[model samples]
Target: MLGATSHIAGRVLPAVGRVPGNVVEAVASRPGRVAAAGEVARRFGARVHDGYDALLGDPEVDAVYVALPNSEHVTWALRALEAGKHVLVEKPMALSEQDCLRIGRAAGDLVVMEAYMYRFHPQQRKVVQLLGRGEEGCGEAEGRGEGEGGGIGELRVVRAAFAYPTPVEGNIRFDPALGGGATWDVGCYAFDVPLWAFGVEPCRVWARFHGDPVDLGAVAVLDFGDGRSAVLDYSLEYGPRAHYELQGTRGSISVRNAWTTPHEDGVITVVTLDGVREEVVPAADAYELQVAAFADAVRGRRESLVVPLDHSVRVARVGEALIRANAVGDWVDLTSR
Candidate 1:
C-alpha cells in the first residue's frame, strides 16, 4: 500500500486478511504520528518500507492500494500502474477528468479501481434490488413508496451528508493546492452513490459553498435526465454524522449512518404510499468486502463494483464544474468537459 498512514488503510489492511490469495507484504511512505501503520504491518508479519519506491521495487509485491491525498492519486496510481502493479485507489480518483484519463491510459492492461467501499455492502445491494423491483413492502423496507399523486416515480430527491470535526491543523484536507475541499472529500460519495443508483449522467448542476481556506461546506443539485434529481450536502464543521435519503414519488428510503468511521451498523427505513416500514441492517465489515472484491478483480474472478475509471472521470468533471459554479454563483454547464 502507498499511504499506510491514512484512516482508510488502517481499516482496509486488516480486512484483506480475510480474503484468500492476498498478503500484506509491505507498508510504505514516511512514518506517521499514530504509528498504527507500523503496528499493522508488524501484526501481519509484513515488512515496513520507509519509502514508497522500496515497496514498488519489491519483486514480490503484486499490487498496491493507494490511500493518498486527492492530488496525489493520479500521480501515484499512474506510477504504480507503470510499475506493473495493480491498483486500488481511494475515491475521487483524480481532481479532473484529464487526470483520470491519464491514469486510466497508464493502466492499459492492469487493474485500476477507485475504492468506494460501501458499494460492496450487502445493505447497498439490497437497496439496489429494492429500487429495481419498485414494489412496496416486497423487500426489506428501508424506504419504499409511490407518491399518491400518480406518475411512476423513480428516485427524486437524494440527500447525502458526510461530516466530521477536524482539529488537525495543516492536514491535507485543508490544503487547497492538494485538492482539499468538501467536494473532493465527502461530496464525491454523495454524488457517486446516487449517480450509480440512477444509472444516468447528470445533465445539469448547481452548487453553493461555505467557508474559506478550504470550503467548510457545500450543497449541490444534480439534474439527471427524466426529471430525476439529486441533492447533496457535506461539511467538516458538523458533529460526526453520515446519512443518505433517496426519495421517490411513492415513498422514500433512507440509510442512517450511511458513511462513518469504524463503519457503523446501517439502518434502512422505507416509507410507502400505504405506510412506513423500517429495517435495521446488521453491522457489516464493509472494508473486508471491499478488499475481497478487489482481490477477486485481481484474480480475474469478477469485475469491480466501484464506479469505473470513465465514470469516475465524469464525476470529477462534474465536481470541477461545481467548484467553478460555487465561485461564480452561477450554474455551470458541464457538457463540454
Candidate 2:
C-alpha cells in the first residue's frame, strides 16, 4: 500500500486481512512519516519504506493499493502500472477530468480500479434489481421498464446526500491541493449513484462550493435532460449522515444509511402503491468483495470493471464544473466546458 499515514489506508488494512490471498506485503510513506508507517508495517506484518519509488521496485510486491491524497492517486497509479503491478486507487481517483484521462492512457492491460467499495455492496445491486435491471450486473448497466413506484409514478428523480461531522485539524479533506473538499470527497459518490442509476451522463450541471481550498459543503443539481434530474447535497461540517432516496412512478425507494451501509446486512424501504415494504439484504463485506473483484480482473476472470476510468473522467468533469459554478456563482454549461 502507498502512504501508510492515510486514514483510509488504516481503515482498510483490517479488511485486507479478511480477504484470503490478498496480503499487504509492503507499505510506504514520506521520510518524515516513517515512524508512523513503520508502526502500521509492524501491526500488519509488512515491510516499510520511506520512499514510494523504492516500494514499486520490490519484486515481492504483486500489486499496489494507493490510499494517498486524491491529487497523487493518478500519479502513483500510473507508476505502479508501468511497474507491471495492478492498482486499486482510492475514490475520486484523479482531481480533474484531464488528469483522470491521463491515468486512462497509462492503464494499458494492467488491472486498475478505483476503490469505491460501496458500489460492491449487495444493497446497491438490490436497488438495481428493484428498478427492473439484472441483479448481477455492472455499475451503470441500463435498466428495463420502470417498475411501478407503488404510489409514485415514472422514475423522475434520485436524491442523494453524504455528510459527516467537521473534519479534524490536519485532515487531508481540508486541503485543496491534496484534492480535499466536500464535493471531491463525498459528493463524488453522491454523483456516482445517480449516474450509475440513470445509465447516462448528466448533460448539464450547476453547483456552489464553500469553505477553503476545497469546499466544506456543496449543493448541486445534475440534469440528465428529459425530465430526469439528480439533486444532491454534501457537507464536511454536519452531523454524520448518508442516505439516498430514489423516486419513480408508483412509489419511492428510500435507503437509510445508503452510502455507508456496511455488509453486516442493511435495509431498503420501498414505498409504492402496493404498500411500504422493507427488504433485508444479507450481510456483505464490501471491501472484501471489492478486493475479490479487483483480483478477478487481474486474473482475467472479469470482463468489465465496476468503476471504469471513463466513469472517473465523466465524474471529474461534473466535479470541475461544480467548482467552476462556485467560482462564477452561475450555472456553468457542461457541454461547453
Candidate 3:
C-alpha cells in the first residue's frame, strides 16, 4: 500500500485482509510520515519504507495500491510500472486525460486498475444486469447478454448526487494544488455511474461551480447525445448522502447508498408498468472483490480489467471539461476534443 491514507488503512486494508492469498506486503509514505506508515504496516505485519521510492524498490512487493493525493497518482504509478509492479491506483487516475493516456501507454501489458471499489459491489452488478449490460468484466462470459437497457427498456437519463461535509482546516479535499474539490473528490463518482450505465462516452458537458479556490459544491450536466443525459450535483459542505436514479423509457431504477454501501446490505428499487419491486443486495466488501480482480489480472488469469485505464481517461476528460466550464461559466463541448 502507498500513502497510508485513512481510507486505505481503515477500509481498503481490512478488505485486502479478508481476501485469500492477498497480503499488504509493505507500506510507505513521505519521510515526515514514515512513522505513521510504519504504524499502519505493523497492523498487517508488513515492512515499512521511509518513502514511496523505497517501497517501489522492494523486491518482494509484486503490486502497489496507490492511495496518494490526486496530483501524485501519475508520477508514482509510472514509477511503479517501470519497476515492474502492477498498480491499483485510486479513482480519477489523473487530473488530465493526457496524463491518464500517458499512464496507459506506459503500462503496456501491466496490470493497472483504478480503485473504484463501489463498482465491484453486487448491487452495482445488479444495476448493470438490469440495464441489460454486464459489469466491467462480467459479461457474456457470465451468460448475461450485452443488450442495452433490456430490463429498463432504454435508459434515457440518470440523476446522481454525492455529498458530504469536509473540514477546510487540514483536509486535502480543500487543497487546490493537491487536486482538491468536491468535483474531483465526489463528483467523479457521479460522473462514473451514468457513463457506466450508458456504456458510452459523453459528447458534451456543462458545469457551474460554487467555491472560491476550490469547489465546495457544483451542478453539472453530461450530454451523451441521442436524447440521453445525466444530471449531477455534488458537494463537500452538506449532510452525508450518495445515490443515483436511472430513468428509462419503460421503467426506472433507484439505488440508495449507491456509492459507499456502508450498511449490511444495499437496496435497489425498480418501477415499471408491471409494478415497483425492491431488490436487497447482501453486503460484501467491494474492496476485497476489487483486490481479487486485481490479483487475477496480475496473474494473467483475467482477460478483462475491472476498471480499465481508458475509462479513467474518459472520466478525466469530463473532469477537465467541467473545470473549464466552471472557469467560463458555460457549457463545454466535448465532441471537438
Candidate 4:
C-alpha cells in the first residue's frame, strides 16, 4: 500500500487481511511519516518503507494500492506501471481527462484500476440489475421486456446528493494544489451513478460552486438528451446526506447510504404503481470485494476491472466539464468540445 492515509487502516488493510490471496507486503509513505507507516505495518504484520519508490522496488510486492492526495495520483500510477506492478489507485484517476488517457496508454496488459470500492457492493449489483444491466460492468441495457429497466421502466432523471461536514482547517479537500474540492472529492461518486444509469456521456453540462480556489459545495445538471437528465449536489460543509433517487416512467428507486455502503445495511426502496417495497442489503465490506476483484484481474481470472480505465476517463471528462461550466457561468456543450 502507498501513503499512510487513515482510511487505509480503517478500510483497506483490514480488507487485505480478509480477502483470500491478498496481503499487505509493505506500507510506504513520504519521508517524515515513518511513524505513521510503522503503525500500519505493525498492526498488519508487514514491513514499512520510508518512501513510495522504495516500496515499488520491493520484489515481494505484486500490486500497489495508491491512497495518496488526488494531485499525486497520475504521476505515481504511471511510475508504478513503469515499475511492473499492478496498480489500484483511488478515484478521479487524474485531474484531467488527458492524464487519465496517459495512464490507460501506459497500462499495457497490466492490471490498473480506479478504486471505487462501493461499485463492487451487492447493493450496487441490485441497482444495476434493476436498471437492466446483467450482473457486471455498465454495458448496454438488456431487454427486460417491460420497455428497458426491469422494475423502473425507462429512466428519466437521477437526483443525487452526497455531503458531510468536513472542516476547512487543515483539510486536504480545501487545498487547491492537492486537487482538493467538493466536485472531485465526493461529486465523482455522484457523477458515476448518472453516467452508469444512462450508459452514456451527457451532451451538455452546467454547474455552480460555493467556494473559491476549490469548491466547498456544488450543484450541477447534466443533459443526456430526450429530456433525460441528472441533478447532483455535493458539499463538504453540510450535514450528512448520502443517497440518490432514480426516477423512471414505471417506477422510482431510492438508494440510501449509496456511496459509503457496506458500513451498515444498505437500503434500496422501489416505488411503482403496484406498490412500495424496500430491499435491505446486508452489510458487506466493499474494500474486501474490491481487493478480491483486483486479485482476480491480476491472476487472469477476471476479464476486466470492475472500474475500468475508460470509465475513469469518462468521469474525469464530466468533472472537467462541470468545473468549466461553473467558471463560464453557462452550460458547456460536450459534443462541440
Candidate 5:
C-alpha cells in the first residue's frame, strides 16, 4: 500500500487481509509518519518503508493499493506503473483529467484501476438487472427490457446526492493544496451513480461552488442532451444524507443510503406505474470485492477492471469542468463549446 495513513486505506488493508489470495505485503508513508506506518505494518504483518519509491521497488510486492491524498494520486500511480506493478488507486484518480491521461499513457497493458468500491456492490448489480441488463455482468445496456423494450427504457433523469454533517478542523478534505473540497471529496459519489448507471457521458456540464478558495458545497448539472440529464448536488454543511434516484420511461429506481449501504444483504425498490417491487441483494463488501478483482487481474485471471482509466478521466473532466464553471459562472462545455 502507498500512503497508508488514510482511514479509507485503513478499511481496505483490513479487507485485503480478510480476502483470500490477497495480502498487504508492504506499506509506505511520509518519513515523519513512521509511527503510524509502523502500527499498520505490525497489524498487517507487512514490511514498512519510509519513502513511497522504496516500497514500489520491493520485488516481493506485485501490486500496489494506493490510498494517498487526492493530489498525490496521479504522480504516485504513474511512478508505480513505471516500476512494473499493478495498481488499484483510490478515487478521483488524479487532480486533473490530463493527469489521468498521463497515467493511462504510462500504464499500457498493465492493470491500473480507480477504486470506487460502491460500483462493485451487489446493489449496482441489482440496478443493472432491473434496467434490463443480463445477470451475467455490468454496463451492457442493450435488449431494452421486460418483453421487447418493456423494462425501464429510455432513462430520463438521474439524481444523486451525498452529504455529511460537516468537516472537523484539519481534515485533509478541506485542504486546498491537497486538492480538497466538498465536491471532490464527497460529491464525486454523485457523479459515479449517474455515469455508471446509464453508462453515458455528458456533452456539456455546469456547476456552482458554495465557497471561495475552498468549497463547503457544490451543485453540478451534467447535460447528456437528448432530453437526458443528471443533477449532482452535495454539501459538507448538510445533515447526514445519501441517496440517488433513477427514472426511466417505464419504471424507476430509488436507492436509500445509496453509497454507504452495508456489505450485508440490502434491499432495492423498483417502482413503475404498475406497482413497487423489492429486490434482495446478498451481503457484499464492495471494497473486499474490489480487492478480489484487483488480485484476480494482477494474477492474470481477469481481463478488465470496473473503473478503467477512461472512466476516471471522464469523472475528472466532469469535476474539473464543474470547478472551472463555478469559477467563471458559465456553463463549461465538455465537448469544446
Candidate 6:
C-alpha cells in the first residue's frame, strides 16, 4: 500500500493480518523517510521501499492498495495497473470524472476497485433489507401502512455528513494543489453512500461552500429521478461526527458514525413501523474485508462490491458539479455526463 504513514494505513495494517489469504508484503512512501517506513515495516514485518517505483517493480507484489491523497489516487492507481497489479484505491477515486474514466480504461485486465469500506458492513446490509420491507415506524409514525414499504424505488431523502478537525498543519488534505478540501476529503462519502444505497445517479446538483483555499464546510443537494433527493453536508473544522439517514415512504434508517466506527462492536439504529430498533452489528475488520474482497476479485473468485469504474466517474462528475455550483451559487445540471 502507498502512504504507509497515513491514518487509514495505520488502521488497515492489522486488519490485513486477519484476512485468510492476505499478507503484508511491502510498504511504500516517498524517499527520505526511511525511519518512518522502517517503523511500519517493523510493525507489520513487511519490507520497506523508499520509492513507489521500487515497490511497484517487485515481481511478487500481486496487487496494490492506494491510500494516498485525493489527487494522487489516479496517477498511482494507473501506474499500478500499468505494472500489472490489481488496484484498490481509496475514496474520491479521482478528482474528476474524466480522470476516473481514464484510469478505468487503463486497468486493462486488472481489477480496479474503490475502497468504500462501509459498504461491506453488515449494518449496511441490514439497512438494505429493512428498506426492502414495507413498514413505517422510524421517521414518520403515520406512514406505517405505506405501500410495499415504498420499495427501493420509493427512496426519497438521503442525508449524510462527516467531519473532523484537521490537526496536521501541512497535511496533503490542506493543500489545494493536491486536491485538498472538506468536499473531497470527507464529502465523498456524503456523495457516494446515497448513490450506493439508491443505486442511481443524480440528475441535478447544487452546493454552497464556506472558507477559502481548503473549504471549511459545504452543503450540497442532489436530485435523483422520481422526486428523490439527497443532501450532503461536510466540514473539516468541526469535531468528529458522522451520520447517514435514508428516508423512504414507509420508514427511515439512520447510521451513526458510519465512516470510522469501531469494527469489532458497532451499532446502527434502524427505525421501522414497529419502532426504533437498535441493531447490534458485530463489525468485522473493514480493511481486512476490503483486502480479501479485492484479492478474491483479483483471483477471479468474486465480483467487486462496487462495480464498474463508471460509478466512480459519476461520483467525480457530481462532485465537480457541486464545486461549480458553489462557485456560481446556482444549480448545476449533470445530465450531460
How well is each residue in 1-337 modelled by candidate 2, as lDDT tens digits?
8978788886677778777777879999876788889999998899998889989999999889998888888889989989988889998888788988888788787778888888787887777777766656547746422554234556689899988887468888888788788888888888887877777777778887778666899888988877888999999998477888888866787778765535357688999777888988887777777887887788887554778777778888888888888788887777664
* Top candidate when judged by TM-score against the true structure: 4
* Residue-pair clashes per candidate: 11, 19, 0, 0, 2, 4
lDDT of 1 by residue, 187-220 (tens): 7877876666565567778899998888988988
Instruction: Please tell me which model should have the higher TM-score, number 2 or number 4.
Output: 4
TM-score of each: 0.89, 0.93, 0.94, 0.95, 0.93, 0.90
Off by over 4 Å in 3: 134-150, 261-263
Candidates' C-alpha lDDT: 0.75, 0.80, 0.82, 0.84, 0.79, 0.77
Model 3 C-alpha lDDT per residue in residues 1-337, reported as the tens digit of each score: 8887556557888778777888889989887788888888889888999989999999999999889888888999999999999999988789999999999999998889888878788887887777766544432212212345536677788899989887788888888899999888898988987777676777888999999688899999999888889999999999587889988888888988865544569789999888989999998777788888888889897554767777788889899999999889888888885
* TM-score-better candidate, 1 vs 4: 4
Better of 4 and 6 by lDDT: 4
CA lDDT for candidate 1? 0.75
RMSD of 2: 2.1
Which structure among the candidates has the greatest lDDT? 4
User: After superposition, which runs of candidate 4 have C-alpha atoms over 4 Å from their true positions?
Assistant: 137-149, 260-263
Candidate 2 ranges beyond 4 A from true positions: 143-153, 261-264
Which ranges of candidate 6 are over 4 A from the true structure?
Answer: 133-153
Error of 3 at 234 (Å): 0.6
Worst 10 residues of 3 by lDDT: 137-146
Whichever of 3 and 5 has more TM-score, that candidate is: 3
Model 6 deviation from native, Cα RMSD in Å: 4.6
Worst 10 residues of 1 by lDDT: 136-145
Error of 1 at 209 (Å): 1.0
Prediction RMSDs, each to the true structure: 4.4, 2.1, 2.6, 2.0, 2.2, 4.6
